[model samples]
Target chain A: MRTHHVTCDDDVKLLAALASNRDAGFEPLVGAYQRRVYGLALRLSASPQDAEEIAQDTFVRAYRALAGYGNDQIRALALRAWLYRIALNVFHNRVRVRRVPTSPLELDDGDGPAFRIEDGDPRTRPEQTLIASETERELAALIAALPPHLRVALVLRHVEGLGYAEIATLLDAPVGTVKAHVHRGAKLLRASLEAHNREEAKVEALL
Target chain B: MTTTNRTPRTPRTPRAPATPPDASLAEVRALLGRLRALADVDAPAALLSAVLGELGLDAADRYFSLRTPVGQIFVAFNDRGLSAVMRGESAADFERAAHALLGRAVHPATEPPARLVAALERSLRGEGKPVLRFDLRGLSEFEQAVLLKALEIPRGEVRPYAWIAREIGRPRAVRAVGTALAHNPIPIFIPCHRVVLSDGTLGRYSMGGDQIKRAILAAEGAAPDVLEELARAGIRYYGSDTTHIFCFPTCGHAHRISAAHIQHFASEAEARAAGYRPCNVCRPALGA
Candidate 1:
């Protein structure tokens, strides 16, 4: 369901193909969006097995739904956003049913010394290098720690490069709420990374 | 400035200025850029097959090509029935078309299942009734009707498209009947090629064009050369001078007559005017 920039011409072509030939047209649709959907599921579920099942379920559901859609509806559909919405719904339902606890983002109080890191001064900013030095696994773990709603909004905005309005439409929330969620999510991520960097530096100094 | 207390407090360091919003956002963007690598996760190739299986489609359908007398013909079928038969097409083309129609990729087998092999042989030899099942799931009602009627045209005999239309009670829908036959998915089983033009000429065919149509008809004991010769000579119906019966040139009973005893007529009126009755076997007057 992550939004990508599919062209209007492509949408028309795909819709036409689907309308006339569901089986042939569906292959290209799956080829186009499978990876992105799988990636979103993986990031959301944080389990490869669950991601695979979720991705498979998303396409099957989409195929069934599109089979009943009229030509005009298919032609006018925003495929990327529509798919993301379905995937997000599937992911959330699975989470609820399984009662799986997503990693939580924990923010220390501002009284922590890491909060004193200056914004404007370039000399005090080692957060970028610290993040760069971390492994991809660690970075994914950090992203996984965000709250579900914020993580979705943040990932859609940053990783997927979707606009606030598009994310709002997908999430069925107000644009203002989406913007606030993304902003707060980013703030928390930066603070958590900064605190981790400070702790690492302390350990290094002790050594 | 407030007056200093007795004991000078340790110089309080000014709190570091808050990180610039733009800088923090840039940091988040950088982190997200790293996460973008996860997008390359390839869903297993079997995922599509899995989905097709879940939908009860033909993902597990078996297919094989047999080199018959006419040409190389590809056939695909599932437990439900034989779904498709295409002539002179490559395996890839057959697979693609099958997938498009059935919503699943069919696997090509080195040898067809025993039952299918037997059915194909019987159908090719134009022998006894072959017991192969047909998967006509997506065909329109008219197409199914036309094809089902076409199946009644016995192995060695051919019927005109008009005959099919009239048989279906849509006598005026001859063109529509042709279109429906042309769209027939399972060709040999449906036998669309057996339907010809009203003038006893081999009409347009959906399989491998008219030539293959002629070949299949010939293999079924219909004389393609005789039909072509009669069409070329502007003969619509052939009348027997001795038997006093008019029959299609492609008819087996008519084919046995010598050219000396045969009287050719372009119109049914001309044949009837000459005191010839329609042959009960060929039924040429049905379309004439």
Candidate 2:
């Protein structure tokens, strides 16, 4: 059951625009996917600053690549998968060079909410809002702490709502391998959550 | 049978099957929903211009004459952000000047974006954090750093070019910082006017002149007259004798220091040696 997707409905229109002129079309293309690309980069690398650089470089590479492509080739591109592939590659190369990845997940103080915040309902209690935000932040930190391969696979599968075959294409891996990674990722995440809940249970008992 | 095509082939030899977490479709959906929410994030506003800045796309695509406290100035922008702010003789003159500066054609826009108009208006009032992004195409890294640091100067207070240099981690580039500020295309919004000379005097402004700079500063609530008097007296900082704190003469607290307890320092070391500490509000040491 695919649960999500990072898709653009105007990929065809955007491609037609780019096919005519890269300059005029690139801004709209960027506008459509900038947040999605930044989200993918942030997931792969747990730092927002790194995510921004990676997203910027990804578009630069994407722009140059599109410039060299034929108009037909440009129109045929699977926009979401193609852009995420570039962003993922950029994130990897950066990690290879920089080596040590320091993310806010390592320090609770440095990270604020990475999730979107809706204006709170007046009926909701302040403490409930606080608890929900805290939970979301903790859940995000747990996702960030996953191993790179599992993290990438799980994010693509669930966050992007992508099929295993589409993810396999993006990862350049076998469909079985991609599915295995997703399965392992989910199992590990569930176990970690259970462990965390038990620890909280002990703290609550003490209190 | 219908679901068989969607499932992947078994890649390895089957071992004892372990209980899979969230095997139920509904539970899996719930788990994935949490992942999606947690993974979603927003891009920063500066990212659009940052891309253009990286691509070196001098995007001075359109212009509109903005009515500002400093008078009418042509503001050029693209989808990224405000690219340039310049004063010229006329519409044709503005087009020619902006074109020469950007090395690109500048078209006249009928109305700037409402958000941009609002940002410009708020900037004139010397408000808090800036709301608009500057495209900053064709500027060197050193120059961009100088301009951005200048933006941090509170509207009414003044810092010397040396303060900008040190703030950007280029302590010896005071003269170069001056050059950068002078070349700043987005002047008033970036607030290059708030930076004065180390001797407490207003300096040359590339957009207009020193007179305009003083006028803008005075409008923002800085006592340009008092700053000039301090420069004439060779007093760069003022100290409260009772409070034992020293601050730049332009500091808001400096204006409140009663005359009887007022002491002055020509240099930071002089104040430090006189048993006075740098004011937390002005941060004399940081600026000096």
Candidate 3:
């Protein structure tokens, strides 16, 4: 998702206003975190409608919980980690109620090269722009198709640029486990992309 | 021999070779960066309002419109309950007045909550007694007392302003009672329409003109035509042959009397002279 970078200063201002029960603090807080929160939700749920509900619910729940906090409590809070935790909880609750499994990676069991390099860089050649766009789309699909637990760790680590310790804190897991999930998730993603490329080459040969 | 063996052991050690970085790992990192840059959609514009509404914050001091037989009635409310009910006023005018009265900004809701709509409908239909709560924040103690006394007037019945003033133990404040009714923030629910002039004429109402007031009274089984006829003819009292009780012309029982069995008296003295006692219901002896 398009990342709208939130500055540290903005978080400080938002937290201060929220601590004092000021209404003006609400808009800025929403603007600062909406994109990242929405992005994380969309990646988790893979449904725009579900993502919207989750995002709205996350902000609402945060607002209510913050309302009861004293100034000191709000000041000491880590807003991003707290918000992500809330969003994750909301997503898990929804998944539990729906009783549907997270989207699984569509790949056959096969061994392939760890990486493949095309002869020419697509961005350098306008003739290969369409192929490059297709590859990007495929990459997004592969990410979305990761198992829920691994996807969460991978997204937090790579997409959100979060460190393993931070992800462990957010997920309430041990740091070692978080690191392993990210590692295995990346390996599986690479394998699935390789398999997909092989199928595409086979189709081209037949054509 | 020991020195030669030590020298040979020292020469046998070699440094371990360094491993190179995987190009595949770099490609995967680049793909993740692209995914992070993908455009995500924003939440719906109404979502913030909806969230506030769900939390009961936006509704704290808001106006909601309801369709009624008279017209669209706008009722402003807060957490306490209904603050004001209005009609025919522009939204801006209503907002200004509500802000002055409630000391908070008032926004117009597309429609009121379902339970409120049902309560209003039942009140309008004059169905079973429905208890309605009100904010009445800006009203004075005397005004609140007058309005609360007016609530005692049953549906399909009208009372004189003096009756409300007397009921509130402020008999000399009859004009003040009128003023309070004129400023009633909640009209239909509190039922200011059930109050009339001492002369039995339907009084001016704040919600709409007197015509709307008359219609509301008629809907409640109070016959405006009969009351108007009696007022025009200067009839102060009516004697019912069935009950042998003379009552004020606006009395519910008095309105039922057939012309053949009806006797009109210009004054309570005339009715008493005719051997008719004052009806306990309307008490014509009290006189308007």
> For residue A201, what is the lDDT in candidate 2?
72
DockQ (CA atoms), all models: 0.18, 0.16, 0.12
CAPRI-wise, candidate 2 is incorrect
Each candidate's TM vs. the true structure? 0.54, 0.49, 0.46
Ranking of candidates on DockQ, top first: 1, 2, 3
Q: Which sections of candidate 3 miss by over 4 Å?
A: A1-3, A22-27, A96-99, A102-137, A204-207, B1-26, B39-47, B59-288
Selected candidate, larger DockQ, 1 vs 2: 1
Rank candidates by TM-score, best first.
Answer: 1, 2, 3
The residue-by-residue lDDT of candidate 3 on B1-288, one tens digit each, is: 000001222222232111124434456457566755543334545556555666555546768777787887778876678888887547888888778766767887666678877878998898877667888756899999988888877787777888787678788899999999998888888889988877777879887798989888888888889877767887767898677799766677877899999998887778877888987776546543
Fraction of native Cα contacts reproduced by each candidate: 0.30, 0.39, 0.20
Sort candidate 3 into its docking category.
incorrect
Chain A vs. native, model 1, TM-score: 0.75
Top model by lDDT, which number?
2
Q: Write the per-residue lDDT of candidate 2 for residues B101-153, one digit (tens) a residue.
A: 88877898877778878888887875657788888868999998998888877
- What is the per-residue lDDT of model 1 for residues A1-207, given as tens digits with 9 covering 90 to 100? 244545777767887888777776786777777777877876666555677788889988998998889877877778888888999989888768867564533334454432221121234236775454335444455666777787787678766767778998899997767766776666666666666677757755866
Tens digits of per-residue lDDT for model 3, A1-207: 344567788788888987776455665676678767877887676555567788889988988888787889988889899999999999888878977654533433345322231222333347655456446545656766777787788778876778778999999997667766776666667667767778778755756
**What number of backbone clashes does candidate 2 have, counting pairs of residues 3 or more apart or in separate chains?**
1
Spell out the clash pairs found in candidate 2. A4-A161
Q: Which candidate model has the greater lDDT, 2 or 3?
A: 2
